[model samples]
Every structure is written in structure tokens, then in C-alpha cells.
Target: MNSTTQATLIKVPAVTLGFWIIKILATTLGETGGDAVSMSMALGYLISSALFMLLFVAMVLWQIRATDFQPLRYWATILASTTVGTTLADFATRSLGIGYGGGSLLLLTLLGLTLFCWQRLLGTIDITSVSNTKAQLFYWLTIMFSQTLGTALGDWTADSTDLGYLFAAGVFSGLLLFIVLLAYFSHISRTALFWAAFVLTRPLGAVVGDFLDKPLAQGGLELSRYSASAALLTSMLLLIILLPQRAALKTH
Candidate 1:
């Protein structure tokens, strides 16, 4: 392929069942891993965020330089973002003393700002057009912020709103179903709907993970975090191995 062709060849994975499975598993692991470090290990949110942010930077650099979509590397980058998101949300809600509602509001604002800036700079927010380095950078930035927002939103619904983790998960899941319906039945832009669904899945995973690990008194299953994390990770690995992986096709 010529330089022009390569320039338009975005390194992205096809959207499939495997993609969604790995995404949810990664988000769930994010919750467990974040809690393991910040709450269980008593590292505190600030320290945890700092640590994961460094990991995010390292992984993102690796991801950018990669010539093609390597599943392990790409998912590792996603995992880093989710882990960072968990700690960042915790810091916003606790150390910063913003509380769940306040932290969620602030993070939502940041998410919106990131999207707005991306749209302004790129002139489009379609994932299909994320072919160049600049657009890829913006895509990841939006993802990081969206993950953080999802964490805060999950916590807000579970704690401040007293909906409990399971209920909160249900609410988010319902919203996801609605989004799917819209994508199928409505004239809404598929690109926009895709991003919206992607962002919503993070929170759904967050609440579901919390629901499994939190204490019984807190409306959780009282499961061991390590056990839950291991199970999810194993499932994700199995799916990734069993399913066929395909790179995004050249549109033109």
C-alpha cells in the first residue's frame, strides 16, 4: 500500500461479541484491581491514581507506535485506563471531598469537555475515522475520561442514591438496552450511539463488579475480590482465545 493508503488505515478491531466480552471483563477487573490497591491494600486513592496514570501513559505510548491492532496490547491499554479510572474516581469522591454526586458531576463535565475538544479539533467524532495519530490520541483521552465518569456514576447511584450495587447495575443495564433499541430502530447516528453504548458499559461493569465484591450488608454478594477478578479474567482470556480476531478493513 502507498503512504496515502497507510495514512487512512486505522488500526482498530472489529466490533463483535468478543470485543464486548473483553471490554466488560476489563472494566470489572478495573473495579476489583482498583479496590484491591486503594481500599484493600490501603494505598489511598491519590497514590493509586498516580501509579495507574503512569501505567496508562506507558501503555498508550506503546499502543500509538504499534503498526496494527494487537489484541493483548490494545486490551492491556484498556485495562490500564480502567484501573486509572477507578482510582481517579475514588480520589475525586473521597480525597478531594467531592462526594459521589459532586465527583460524578465534575467527571461528567470533564468527559463532555474532552469530547467537545476532540470534535473541535478533528471535525468529527466517528470512531471509523480514527486513522491518524492525533485522532487516536483524542479517542483514548475520551475513553479515559469516560471510564472515570462511569466509575463515579456507578458509585453515585449505589451510595448517595442508596440504590445499592445490584439495583444500580440494573438501571445502567436498562439504559444500555434502551441504547441498543435506539441503535436498531431509530435514525440516530450509529457512530454516536456506539460511543454512548461504549461509555455506558463501563459503569455497568463497575456496579456489577461492586455488587459481587461488596459486603452483604451493603447489598452485595460478599464474594472475594481476588476470586471474582480471577474468574472474570479467565473468562475473558478464554473468549479472546476462542474467538477470531480481525482488524478494521480499509474503507476506501
Candidate 2:
């Protein structure tokens, strides 16, 4: 493809093992960092949500205006979305008294509606089609909802079922493994599998984050959230720098 075509390629990273690794770390950082500000710092969910939402909006606009795929900008936006999603989900489920199940169902419904509209309007929900502003909007919106839903779902599984955080993480990790197997062994839709993995990773990260920081009395290690967030953030940055980052090739 020519330079112009390349420039118009999707402003998201190509799906690769490295991408998934970094994504999980980002989501884990989101959980820890969000809790650090909202819970540890006593900012409360509403204020934290507002702050993170503003940051997410700014990052998304910056990402949308970029002329080509910029790995740093793209990942930064993803982190912002996840952090905002964490706080927003917490606010909805706990502060609003919606409960985890209620919040998950509500966010899941929103995600379904967003995907349905995107598919109806664009005829495809593939990430490779996220080359233009409209598609980017839909892509980010879907991702935000998925992240929020993941948070609520993770909390519900861990807290409501007596499964504990590690067990909950295991559950999500197992589901992700199943998706990977289907991707290789079945004729399942690649796009659907990609989304399935994407959604599952968030919950895995969420529970893992909780496990790292929650009190021992609550089955967590009681580690400092700030330190955990810093470690996860550093790990993500290292992986991004060490691994090749390239835009997903646009598909006709």
C-alpha cells in the first residue's frame, strides 16, 4: 500500500500476543490506580469518575486527531478509558446502590446496543475498520462500556459467590483461554473472538488488582494500591517499548 493508504490505516495496534499482554497490564493498572485515587485517597467514586472521565475525553480527542497510528497515544487512551470505566462502574454499582449484578446488566445492555448500532451503521465491527472518526467513536464507546461491564462482573463474581479474588481471576483467565482455543480450532468469527478476549481480560485484571491490594482479612494481600499501580504501569510501558507497535492494516 502507498503512504496515503498507510496513513489512513486503523489507529489501533495490530492484534498480537504483545498487544494482549500490555492490555492486561493496563487494565490491572486501571483497577489499582483507580482505587488509589478513589478509595485510598478518599476522593470518592463520583469525583474520581469525573476526573478520570475528563482525562479519557481529552486522550480520545487527541487520539482521534492524530494523523496516523501512534502507539503511545493509543495506549494512553486505552488506559484512560479503563481507569474511567473502573470508577464509573464502582459508582454505579456501589454508590448508586445498583449492585454488581444490576450494574453489569446495565452496562452489558449498553455495550450490546452500541455494538448493534455500530454494526448496523458500518456493516462491520472489526477493529481494522476503525480508520475514520465515526468508526473510532464507536470503537472507543464500545470499549468503555466493555471495561465498565468487566469491572462490575468481576466484583460480582468475587464478592457475591464467595469465590474470592484469585478464584475470580482464574475464572476469567479460563474463559480467555477458551476464547483463544476457539480462535485457533473453530470457524468462529475472528472479530467476535477478539471482542470476547478483550472483554474477559478486563475482569481478569480487575480481580487480580483486587487481590493485590485488598486486606488479608478480605483474602487480598493488602499491598499498597499506589505501589501496585506503579509497578503495573512500568511493566506496560516496558512491554510497549520492547515490542513492535504497528497499526492494524485496514481491510476493505
Candidate 3:
């Protein structure tokens, strides 16, 4: 590759309003898409997780190979993470008999460890530092853990707490908004808030997606998983095309 290609722009997207909009939508799509595979197709969580993990690996490889940011590729990688996250969380929480509480705690611990390791190695967990190979590896690892945690947390809130889907969605949405308030008015670290908001977005999407796809008896809209996933996918694509996505400013 040429020197210009070698010294490419940041691979991660900039932190913009459009980025969050697409992120939340992509995550919701993840929930619906994952359910289509694991539940609707009766593939079981194990098989569905394996399938989505393959796609995640492929997308991550493609992402690591590309010298510059590509919006579609980045979003594809995000989608892969969330889809795999859904089934993986299900396998751990349900299939392995861990229950949602155990699953959430375990995943949260793993996420904390991942971040601690990233901090040890990189000295900072700022998303903008995700420019080189090593940083990207840490970035994706943290994302996977956060995604899994979100799934378990969302399920725990909805099922174990008996708050139902809408209320669960509201709960997470409120938490995210509170984080936003901190980001705006408080002296808290933006990096911390970024990760906080990032992790919370998944659960918000999780409950909303469940609300759409679950049966009427279950307090959901009773929509078809395939149809719901397709609509969410289409919305993301439209937003990607319609909005602006710039590469994060390089700090390395």
C-alpha cells in the first residue's frame, strides 16, 4: 500500500448526533435480526451464535484490513457485533442455566476486565485513539462485552423485573438521557460517558425490538421478526445515506 493509504484517517466514526441515531437503530435491528435466526428459524441460541460469530469475524477482518473509514463497512461490523451479542447472551443466560442476573453480572465483569486491560495497554480508553491495530483490537473486544451485557440487562429488566418491554425501554432510555445530562452539565469524563452511553444504547434497542416482535400476549406489537428486522435495516441504510459520518480525528 502507498504511504497515503498507510497513514489513513481514523477507522472509527466521529461522535456526532447522526452517529447515535444510526447506532440505536442498528442495535434495534440486531435484536430483531438475531431473534429471526435464533427463535423464528428455531436454530437455537448456540447455532445462531456460531453463525453470527462467523459473520462478526468476517466483518472485523474486513474492518481491520481497510486503510480508511467506510460507513457501510463500519455499520456492518456494528450489526454483526449486536446480532452475535443477542444469541450469545441468550445462550449464556438461558441455555446454560445462568439466569439473567448471573449472566448480566458475569458479562459486566468481563467488560470491566476488558476495559481495565485496555487501559493498562493503551493508557486511555478514548474512542478516538482507535486508530492502530492494537487499539482496534481492544475497541472491538470492549464492544462485544458491552453488547452481551446489554442483552442480558435488557432481558433481566423485562422478564425478571416484570416491568415488561415498554417500561424496560423507558428505564434504559431514562438512564441514557441521564448520562447525556452528565455529559452536558457535569465535569465527568467524556470518554467514560461515551462508553456509558454506548453500552446503554444496546439495552434500549433490545427492549424496543422485543416490544415490536414479541407476541401480543407478551405485551408486544406482535410484528413478524423478519419484517421488523427488514424495516430497521432499511431505516439504518437510509440514515447512513442521508446523514453525515466522518472519521474520528486521529490522535496518534
Candidate 4:
């Protein structure tokens, strides 16, 4: 296909600083919003997970059927996936009595398997190649797993260790910074780096969200989850509107 046609086929946004900024905010919003429903409202993790899972499925379907890139639609789907990830992780770790470490291990294994299958089927797990329906399926599925894994990792680092929320956030932030350095200064695979950074951002957002909303006795600020979620949502929307993202060009 010609460049024009290839460009038209691309539906996901380009990987830019703006994209990462908005993504972190979306994940933070997901944590607070999910907690608001499941914990604050006393809906329980299982019920909340079911509700968010349905919403996530609907958003993915909408995204898959779209003919062109739509920023709002794309971010909405991301937000849905993150919210579901939060509740699902909570249910697995707390309700199932698996502990945060066990939950993180399980989700990490699932994410790795998804990526392995996606690579074996498509020959590449690069986001730039996600222009067709098959690739989109793998893309969203990988994201779902990654988001869930991230939530688990965040909780593990914060609660299961001496790191607490702020320290856990710092650790993830440092790791992400290391990835950025590798992207600029090393010869490592760009695709690998992208995925690594993408996965790490979720935990960073998770810890930050917990720090914002969890009780002060637990090393948090005890802010209202609803208010925190609203603030994060507003920030994401503002960034999306002000810094319009373009579709990632197909490389394959």
C-alpha cells in the first residue's frame, strides 16, 4: 500500500510525551475511580470488576469497529481497561487471598503469555503495526493484561514492602527514567523499551493514586477518591484537547 493508505489505516496515536502524560493520568484516574466504586461505595471488588469489565468490552468493541482514529474514543477505551484492571487485581489479591505478590506474579505471567502469542502470530508486538483488526485484538488484550499486572505490582511494592505508596511511586518513576535513558543512549530494541515503559507507567500511576486517596494512617493523604478521580479525569481531558495526538504510522 502507498503511504497515504497506510497512514489512513493507523488508528492508535503516536507515542509522544503528551501520550505518556495523558496515559499516566488516565491510570491514576482508574485507580481512584475503581476504588470509589468498589471500596467507597461498598460494592465489593467482584461486582465492581464485573461492571468495569463490561464497560471495557464495550469500549474495545467500539474501538475495533471505528474507521479512523478518534482521540476521545481511544482514551475512553484506555480508561475503561485501567478501571477494570484495578478492580480485577484487587479481587484476585485480596478476595482470593493470593496476596499482592502472588497476584503480581500471576498477572505478569499472563501478560508475558499474551505478548508471546501476539508475537508468534503477528511476527511483531510493535504498536506501530496495530492497524488491522487482528493486531488491534492483540494490542488491547496485551494492554488489559499489562494494566492488571501493573496494579498488582503497585500494590505489592507499596503494601507488601517497606516502600509504602510514595516510595513505591519513586521506584517505578526511577525505573521509567532508566527506560527513557536506554531509549536515548542505548542500542536496545525500541519496541521492547516501549512495552517496558508502558507497563511501568501503570504502577507509577497506581501508587500515586493510592497516595492521594488512601487513609493517612496508611501513609496516604486520605483525599476523597471521587474528587481525586474527577481531578485526574479533568487533567486527561484537558491534555487530550490541548495537545492533539496523531495516529501512529504503520511500519509493517
Best by TM-score: 4
- Give me the displacement of residue 217 in model 4, in angstroms: 0.9
Ranking by TM-score: 4, 2, 3, 1
Lowest summed lDDT window (length 10), candidate 3: 1-10
Model 1: pairs clashing at backbone N, Cα or C within 3 Å: none
Please give the CA lDDT of all the candidate structures: 0.85, 0.92, 0.92, 0.93
Candidates 2 and 3 compared: the better one by TM-score is 2
lDDT of 2 by residue, 56-88 (tens): 999989988988888888999999989998999
Candidate 4 wrong stretches, greater than 4 Å: none
- RMSD of each predicted structure: 2.1, 1.1, 2.2, 0.9
> Mind sharing the TM-score for model 3?
0.96
Tens digit per residue, CA lDDT, model 4, 16-122:
99999999999999899999999999999999999999999999999999888889999999999999999999999999999999999999999999999999998
TM-score of each: 0.94, 0.98, 0.96, 0.98
Pitting candidate 2 against candidate 4, the one with the higher TM-score is 4
Give candidate 2's error at residue 233 in angstroms.
Answer: 0.7
lDDT of 4: 0.93
Q: For residues 1-252, could you state the per-residue lDDT of candidate 1 as single tens digits?
A: 764455435666777767877898899889988888888888999999999999999998888888777777778899999999999999998888988888888888888888899899888877766777898898899999999989988888888889988888889889989988998899998778888888888888899889889999889998888888889888877877788876655454
Model 1: CA > 4 A from native: 1-8, 250-252
- Report model 4's TM-score to 2 decimal places: 0.98
